[model samples]
Target chain A: MSATDAEIYATRSFTETEVPMIELKGVSRRFAKKLDVAAKLARKLGADVKEEVVHAVDHVDLRVRKGEVVGLVGESGCGKSTLGRIVAGILPQSEGQVLWNGQDVATLPGEAARTAKLRRQMIFQDPYASLNPRMRVADIVGEAPQVHGLIKRGGFDEYVDEQMRRAGLDPAFKRRYPHQFSGGQRQRIGIARALAVQPEFIVCDEAVAALDVSIQAQILNLFMRLRRELDLTYLFISHDLGVVEHLSDRVVIMYLGRVVEEAPTERVFTAANHPYTRSLLDSVPRIGNRKRAFATVKGEIPSPLNPPSGCHFHPRCPLAFDRCKVEVPKLKAVDSLHRSACHLNDRA
Target chain B: MSAPTLEVRNLCTHFFTRAGVVKAVDDVSFTVDRGKVLGLVGESGSGKTVTGFSIMGLVDAPGRIVSGSILFQGKDLATLSEEEMRHLRGNRIAMIFQDPMMTLNPVLRIDTQMIETVLAHEKVSEDEARQRSRDALGMVGIPSPDERLKSYPHQFSGGMRQRVAIAIALLHRPELIVADEPTTALDVTIQGQILAEVQKLCATTGTAMIWITHDLSVVAGLADDIAVMYAGKVVEYGDVGEVLDKPLHPYTHGLIGSVPSRNKRGEPLRQIPGMTPSLLNLPEGCAFRARCPRAQADCVQRPELREWLPARLARCHHPHREEAAAA
Candidate 1:
């Protein structure tokens, strides 16, 4: 079968499942100005506010089913990291709700305490920055379990040893500091720390981007191995489409703080409906693939502070028309389980 | 064929330290034709950047061009005095750094930096220099070029700052420009735009360029010719398509195969084993022998970059052509 036909078949097979493990409904987060008490009182009394708010995470909707890895791909400062943070419940949403296993996360009493118990962990982009410089590998990996009270008294060392081994790290290296390890080794420690709490869901935010190509493969394979062994779910965020294609079961393409297209991995790769998605795929240089033409997208991404009035991608899109510039395109289904936010995809 | 625009012959750049000498660019040689782009691809510490620096006469104290000659337009730049080299630097040659901030001063406005650049090279009025600066900014696709000129470097975004730096380099219309990963930090869209602009400028003005980057994909699209650098030397040099399609050196083949895009999905990436050797303690004979998959006893003798084909060169005793043709 052709790649497109296989993609269609795969999309049709994905809708047999029910409700997702995690869902975000119209989630929007804006950062408020840091005002002093007197300034805050003045604003409360109807005084003029001078500071500007940053709309970091605009209205976004997404869902990740149980045991499925969802990849969120976008450039830096496109709100991929912000959305990931909101989904992980590390940051509070200014508007909208996050449903975790059919329950509103914000409504839960001591939400932080509850999420901590639920075992939703985030692996940061830079391993060097995420791992504490002064702390040894043993304490860095062991502290999560100690804080969550997962291990019994005097069993912390054994627990740390087990986690390190599970992450394919040498147990002896636990005594070494973060500075003593290479880029890949430090990332393994980061993974070991995340797994110590036995989290079912992980948010890997550009986990392997900072490492070399050889080291990247090692970490990616380690992640895959850990996932199968632990039955973990992942929300993988990265700018690299190649890495995402290798890891994700489903993929969401984001542009300027909003999702532009989302579908099963095969469908998105083979038959992307959105113009932006198609351009991005074409930009990736492939070896021994002479049939594919290079489609260089014109113009730079518009600044988020003053975005376009209608479709954010209309500025650089070659297929953009008057309708695209005036009306915001809502994401609609192009086929079963395949959705895109471009007006051209609006068959109706 | 016409003579190459810039011919680097046995160029060896070294850093003399208290411990020992660091052989950064050891006996590296290549040539670029007029209006052509030569991509120097390598991993960090491969000495690609140092080679570009050596050509521009930017090597600092304690680190100098210990031997060899850099012939630009038939003039040996290595033998020129500091004053003569300084005159040639911004006038006849230019360089774009990885970090735009390194090329730009945070305290100065865009117009001030660009106008000063023009006035330093030529006797021109401030208004004329400002006009030339505005044109340069517009050429690089910076919108509202005049308004952006009044703004400081800190005011521009990362990609925009890089565009401004590139624009500054283009003001003099130098015969050759050595760009050292200037677009590595930008997004793919911005990178594409910059590459297109650079290619257009080169084609229109008949200027030569050396684009030094580790990104093989960018080189595939932007470079006319490619030179794979390893252990402070060019292991292979040929047309971009020829080298990428049929790499002569084993190291070049491994480098191309290691990219994630080339491998099958879910398959383990093909990587060259072992880390880059220390420049201060390089092994004798072939620098890549430690990691080469096809290393043999004959590799113990150092191989020069001899012609494997017409206009193609490789420093490997066993080029891929013999094996493949024999098969």
Candidate 2:
């Protein structure tokens, strides 16, 4: 009933020995507020109006090898989705470099950049919001490929049908609009659209979080099946640790727009090194556990608009000491494949 | 034991729309003992919220409680007039909603809202009402209630705002509380904190609660009893531990099994096939027949909630025998 490590990893299309397919170095995205007319006038009057900058992602370093499923876990406004969008090139990072296939994607030549864009795709969280209500399933799924000249007009229907079949949708429903499909079916249409572009890597931002549990499972299975069949890699971003644990090869934990911890899924689940990661695991309600009580991590997630100095989590963390307030912890290796950012790790 | 605080018998609430009459809550029956929490677990459109609304007499014109006796402290809530029901509501029965804003006024300060709720229910002076509001906020783990009281609802975070809503609900010490997915919008830690506080309140004040949610694990932790609903009917009902450990109904079994945590990692989940039938046009027999694995031709007659074991009930044509379930 249980999968052995060898059995699980045997299905992996790529190994760690392979060079990273995508790498983010010092990736930081900042959003600056637009001042109102009054504020602009006040600033003109020498009131010393300081422009507020919301740091959505701060100096994050990440690597994803070919065919690896990296789960990004965090609470709301933790910059996980922003990070995902940055990877998929939908959003431009304010600073730092995004290297695709060890080459900087931004500096790539015109055609090369377009090629890179086609290789990496993003699947959004809400099926209803992302899909076009006016477009039929065929047009929605076939649009990208057709516009990009990947599929000829004559062969568009067949190509769309193939992508639909891969995504677990009946091709016969191609004529139906987004409104006609259920939540799961609409999500499949989204997936089919993404697959139509022939992507090698996908950044799924809370892909199944909106669906019911049963429908979620169906979608999760489809993702796994696609990964196996197409040798696809994913940067799967979700708030649900259970889903992340079920689907991820490695897990990355973020807090207030910073990478707090990174480890293989087993290591993160069994013995998390960071206090924030530990608390996130503790809060999940285990299905079969008879006793149901936990000391919840105190305090709400602080606003990302004005994140704390030094350690963002220190204010709410239980083991926070004086040193945690003044020093931003660098991610250091706790083990072979695990890295954690915490003041307590200094003792180790 | 003392009589159950709230007993609902054959409760059915239907929505009359231009399309057709939608039976949102169909012939549902359950009881919550004093100090006990009954978790009404179901997916969206399963009528768990309607059942809660029926108890609070909050179901609007389009929706009406057709037939059922909602016995609250030996009185029928279904028959109560709007005036009488309004008097009882927020006094002996309080309901919390999914969005804290549903219970909170966005423009008002926490203290003003809380004090008004208390004064409206009880004959209390302004100072005493304010003090009660402060105490209620403190009881739900909001820090510095006095300071929080002066702040507008917008100033509080999502978690804190929900706490304020919960505090207002508890100000009058209502005998029955119907919380409809109050913590669904919150983060896990915040949700755990609120659930812990609610559980403590029920234990300390002997308040009966009907906690309606789609999450089974949450129900397992918070509720003494659970009623798993499908297509407007409770397919299974029993003690939380007993029912979850050995769910008899196929729908309940499929639901529990579908949760990612229930399956070993890397393995496919034991998902129940097919989607829930539309509420407008449910199946002729058992509403769950379309998705139930054990469904047969004989499921045409809808099964009633009957005892499958001591203190346990399941509406199933083919419930798993104890031996069959063990394997």
Candidate 3:
């Protein structure tokens, strides 16, 4: 495809009734411990060594419509980042299919696959780590587009300047390296780089987690402004519920590789169905909840390598019972627009 | 109210670097009474952490407490010898770092570390130390403390490891604890659990705490009083509720306004323009002047921290008045 074709495809609008911008059908990703030669030799000698497999993303299904902001909320080991990677097409799912615009990405032709790859971009959590120290800001933001044939070589500097300006960075400082910029400025550089690719979907994996509160607000505003200007769909992954509630149109709560609740943002915050979701909402330290004693879930998050047999959250769940420990609850619709994976939902 | 547990007066801990003198914690002050929690809050380079380190007598060479009186129950900690401070370090006073791994010896078992902490300050048998270690673990809400005691620090999860660190800090029933962002690295749910334990411990044991952190929400729910630090100085100090609800200083106002929940959804947040100024070779007068929306010509003169309301102090020439805040 030519540059104009890519531009046309990037700017193509879709109604909410149409196919989702991205969809995950029964997606599951597993990470297994690889045995080295020594470990293999020990295993052959009848040592009590076993390969451990971690189900990072268990048969999860999701759909994000065009221009929708889907907030994926989870704790440290909940596999939200893995799921986001799969959705961004940077990582492949061990099972099931990742559909882009109603077409399975695995089976797409050469040019179509490349286009799909280019259409999705990611903004990482740590700005200091994600960016290369050696590269100047102009090259960092301009390289991908030039390499991908999105811009002509002569128009490179102009394109980089435009992207930087859109991301709220001074293009005059584009000659400086990443180390010279502040954390928030480096994040804007990352944003500028992602926008340089002209992506329709952006996966922000804790993009503002490293910055200060005031800087966080500045970056969050830039994101909203970019969304308004470019009509972008975002998969915002964060552990902070307040940020998720502020940006997301819909919220999906994950616990130990499984999504426990999915609902409209307002519904998830107000009338959450899953016990884990309720616990998470309660656990968030809010400015309004001043001098309030926090209500914590009972135990630590279980090891994903040896997750609970039935529900992953059952061990720490306060309302867990015999059924929760013995049955793997299915994600079912609890309301017209809300879905929850909990045994209590069956009874209700 | 009887001779507050820790009263930091006119603290100035500066780093004498070759580049220049970096005033990390200059003229900072706060008071934490017994059983009360004081939150020292700021962004990075705001000198909150330096203040905590100064109070603990942990400021190494090249960084010295230039001027200050850290009155701990009528004793000035700044004047103490290294050997004397060593005695008070973990016995009567304790410090909790941000990373649990910093406190926990990875090669040793949890029991060994806790027992060593107990034995360091007291003449107790190994069995008695072990018993105290087990009790401390149990007190921090670690389930099956006996089993957990035998496990290595790596065997425990992040939250559990932090609990072990906190339990070690509590071994001597330290009269004062200086916790520098202890829960900043944990998940929110885990942080909530840890904060709950700390709150309960402070309430029941009457152990004064100075919780230094960059998060306002965490401080709001945990601290009885708060000191807002900016450019190595206390910009505002007052009761937690008053400081959060009716912030007098523009820096505090901007900080509060920038929270995600405070703004209308999908709209632009009220952001304080420009990043935090560099500590080394800082501009004259207010360090926050460049970012303050209410900054004017008068802001060029450094404002002293003075009482604006009853029990409230702010360091700003043109503070946000009550009438102005109402309007």
Candidate 4:
């Protein structure tokens, strides 16, 4: 069946009209590398040492409607994870506003703030590292709900078991520690824990990246199933384009700390407008397309500490011009649902 | 074809741990001809890495090559001494690890490492070694080889460091190179560049390579032959095009099906059920029987790796019929 036949849920048709579950407006996250005493002394002695700041996420604007799955794609240190964290509310944005259901999250009252925090949950890449080894699966899944008083009195066991079953885990194995279970099983436990809190939105940062092909498929299937059953929205961050293409309704391409392109999954894959996106699509090795010469983006990803002058991808872009080095390209609309950042687009 | 660059026959590398004997690479064998690339594909703990280590004679401590002969151009590497192996290790048989840092020394300049590698392998002058090192760096697509050669390992990016490691592996123009996921840690764009360089290197130099990785798409594109390992054994082996297009073994079929691009988007992937069994105390007979959909009672008798079809070999009691595979 074609991907366009995605009719398990009717959410996609009315997505544009619905109030976005989460919205990011010009969000930016910066991390400052403080100079040590020795470096500070060296600076005073004319050693050219100075404090540096990494703009992890810079002026990114995004919106995820209820039940929408938006895939965030980028190379390592490109700020996809940082963007996900900002959306999840775990890491506060260095600048800009985060609106939850058309309400500012930062200025929300005590009860509303608490609700907002619990409603948006995150699933990390490494299942082994994300979970608590000391705690049993039962406690890991149920603790948040219990602590938050979401569970009915004396019904904790049944509640945790239901969550486990929903995530396709055998509830009988709930008493086992994280080390006892395999990688896929541990990911399921993490999903169960997220669902236990009744989250409306989930931020999965390279969730299935560490899994083997067969196991990655199983986990991706689980994510799809959960979305259909729970009507959940997702900001799925991943480096694997194939996985992103399979699940995401919309795809957002990031470079350094900026949003370079955003479009429907099919458009992003078939007719990518951004040079970076096009190069990324070309680089993906295809099964059956054997012995073909790989078309690569020219250079290594410039260090995020001091990104390129204008377009972050300019250094590696094949069609890079003098204008690309001096002026940052704005993410302008190419189609009703498609947007791209490239000087070539303006020239055209 | 030049006595086949490397022929591994019935190789078994096991670890004698306190708990039990873990047969990491059990009765695995494959042949790589001159200028041919053999892709060793498997999931974690499938012994693909161990097989690479076995060929390089790098397995140490509890892990040892218990049986089988690694014939490198008619010479038996399995029977070779540490001294003899060392002489051939960096000179003739080179290895590029998953992490570049594992191959590169962080403290030393790139030149010192590359120059020393040349001096250890051959009677070459310092100037000649340094020039060869510079040329090798440029060969792997690294720009300004002279400047890069002076920089420390930490100065280069992840992709550049990996390129440097590959250049070191190519320093002696080794007859055989064992690359264990050399590009796995690199970005997709960088990975593409590296793959292209390696592909061209093999074709031009006739340098046989054994590439060990878990990504099927990569293997499908780059390898001439493919070996699919499961639970420390090679369950399937054949030409890359033939094996991936119409796999004879159930494990190979499932693995090819599991790739996201192969499946219809939004549908559940054709995944194999159950996890890989532990190497220690592995079940008798087929290690994949528990997860194989076509497994039968005959699977109880350990299946031999025999010819299932023309040029295709699989360890299975009941290999998938040609008709079924075509469908």
Which of the two, 2 or 4, has more DockQ? Answer: 4
- TM-score to true structure, per model: 0.90, 0.97, 0.96, 0.97
What does each candidate score in C-alpha RMSD? Answer: 3.6, 2.1, 4.0, 2.1
Model 1: how far residue A6 lies from native, Å = 12
Query: For each candidate, what is chain B's TM-score?
Result: 0.97, 0.98, 0.98, 0.98
* Runs off by more than 4 Å, candidate 2: A1-18, B323-327
lDDT per residue, candidate 3, B1-327, as tens digits? Answer: 389999999999999999989999999888999999999999999999989899899998799999989999999999999999999999999999999988899999988888888988999999999999999999999999999999999998899989989999999999999999999999988998999999999999999999999999999999999999998999999999888888999999999888997665566778999989989878788888888888999888989999978898999999987743473
**DockQ sort, best first:** 4, 2, 3, 1
Candidate 1 local accuracy as lDDT?
0.84
Off by over 4 Å in 1: A1-17, A35-50, A107-118, A149-162, A165-168, A285-295, B280-292, B296-306, B309-311, B317-327
Per-residue lDDT of candidate 1, residues A1-348 (tens digit):
223433443355345445667888999888756888888899899999656566777788988876777889987678899998888878888889888875778776795557643578889989889989999999999996898788999999899999999887889888899998877788889999988988888999999888766567668878877776888889999988888887777899998878899988878889898988888887765544332234568877777767787888998899898998899899887777888998986644
Model 3 lDDT tens row, A99-146: 999999999999999999999999999999999999999999999999
- Alpha-carbon shift of residue B171 in model 1 (angstroms): 1.2
Write down the RMSD of candidate 1 (Cα, Å): 3.6
Residues B1-327, candidate 1: write the lDDT tens digits. Answer: 877789999999999998899989989988988998898998878899999999999999799999999999999999999999989898889999999988899999999999999999999999999999999999988989999999999999888899899899999999899999998887766676677778788888888999999888778887888999988989999888888888899988887776766666555567676667778888788988998889999898998998888787999898897643343
TM-score of chain A of each: 0.89, 0.95, 0.94, 0.94
Local lDDT at A79 for model 1: 88
What is the CAPRI rating of model 1's predicted complex? Answer: acceptable
What are the Cα lDDT values of the candidates? 0.84, 0.88, 0.90, 0.91
Show the colliding residue pairs in model 2: none
In model 3, which residue pairs have backbone atoms overlapping below 3 Å? none
Model 4 stretches astray by more than 4 angstroms:
A1-18, A38-50, B324-327
